[model samples]
Target: MLRALVFDFDGLIVDTETPLIEAYGDVYREHGVAFDRAEFERQIGHASFAFDPWRAFGAGADREALEQERRAINLARTERQPVLPGIRELIEAASAAGLRLGVASNSSHGWVEGHLRRLGLHGFFSAFGCKGDTPAPKPEPDIYRLVVNALGCRSVESVALEDSAAGVKAALRAGLWVVAIPNAATADHDHDGAHWTVPSAAEVSLPALRARFGG
Candidate 1:
């Protein structure tokens, strides 16, 4: 029986992908390098830190400088970030159904918290686990394991809602069932091992989730 629902913060819970992509593109333009959206998605989606396109452009970019630039752009964009459609309703429904809620994402705690606060959804989660909270980020089971443990639920009694292949792998590796909601940025990625790959979280009814986990 599923006792908890874990979520990925960025693309899954909110529509932050477009803003992130725009930010990266803006930063790249400063250095006279065009940012390739597809390439950026492929690389940065799998890494904890933002990729430095200037370095890839052979500009001898310093990692710290790129990080600073990325941070400034991200913060500016985040101020206007909005939650995904039906996200609040789904969260409220899940909460009303008595499902424990948690957040596990590759983003830093500050980034996740800022977004959540902006959307006024910060209080819905019982626990928030971020990249720095765990020994490693997504594709690693540590963060998912931490959430299940914090929720006081068995791994088998928990379900993780993710939008990326890496997030699915991490949740599954942690012994929880996974429901994938692939976003535009990661829709082309393979989710062959996911228990289900839905178009959006709005389509994931509470009954369907419970049924999948035999709760």
Candidate 2:
């Protein structure tokens, strides 16, 4: 039986990833500098990525002020984002079916929880295994394992809903069935590692997922 469902936070639950990248791009644009979108994409689904987005502005640039501006832009854009399509319905259906719901993400617990709460979907989750909760994040299976354990279910008895290649690898490594639903920002990512790929969360249904995964 499918005892649990674990979700990835940023791109999957909310489109925070796109807004964040756009915020950085906006800052770069204001300074008449070009933004390397492909470079920023490297940090999409994992934590502790080594990237220096401000190097293009040269040594004389005010890093602190620029970061502040970028953050403000990001916050404004992020606040306007709604829960991704069909995510709310999928969560509701999974909940009504008595399946445990949880989140496993590379982001900090505060980040994930804050967004979920803002979207009015926080109460549906029972466990959250985020950054600092485990030794490592997605691509390591640490976060996924932590959440599955917290949900009191084996990895095989759970399904992982993800939006990135790294997240798919993590869930697959943890032995859970993975469904990849890439967002606009992640649409170009290679998600061949996932068990299945859907255009959007709207294509997902609890019954169909369980049937596909033998839950």
Q: TM-score for each prediction?
A: 0.89, 0.96
The alpha-carbon lDDT assigned to residue 71 of candidate 2 equals 88
Model 2, residue 103: distance off in Å is: 0.4
As for candidate 1, its clashing pairs are 1-215
CA lDDT, every model vs. true structure = 0.81, 0.90
* Tens-digit lDDT track of model 2 for 1-215: 78999999989989999999999999999999999998787778978557777999999999999999998999999999999899999999999989999999998888889989988999999999988888777789988999999999999899999998889989999999999999877788889878889999999998899898766
- Candidate 2 C-alpha RMSD relative to the actual structure: 1.1
Q: Where is model 2 more than 4 Å wrong at Cα?
A: none
Query: Global lDDT for candidate 2?
Result: 0.90
Off by over 4 Å in 1: 49-52, 59-67
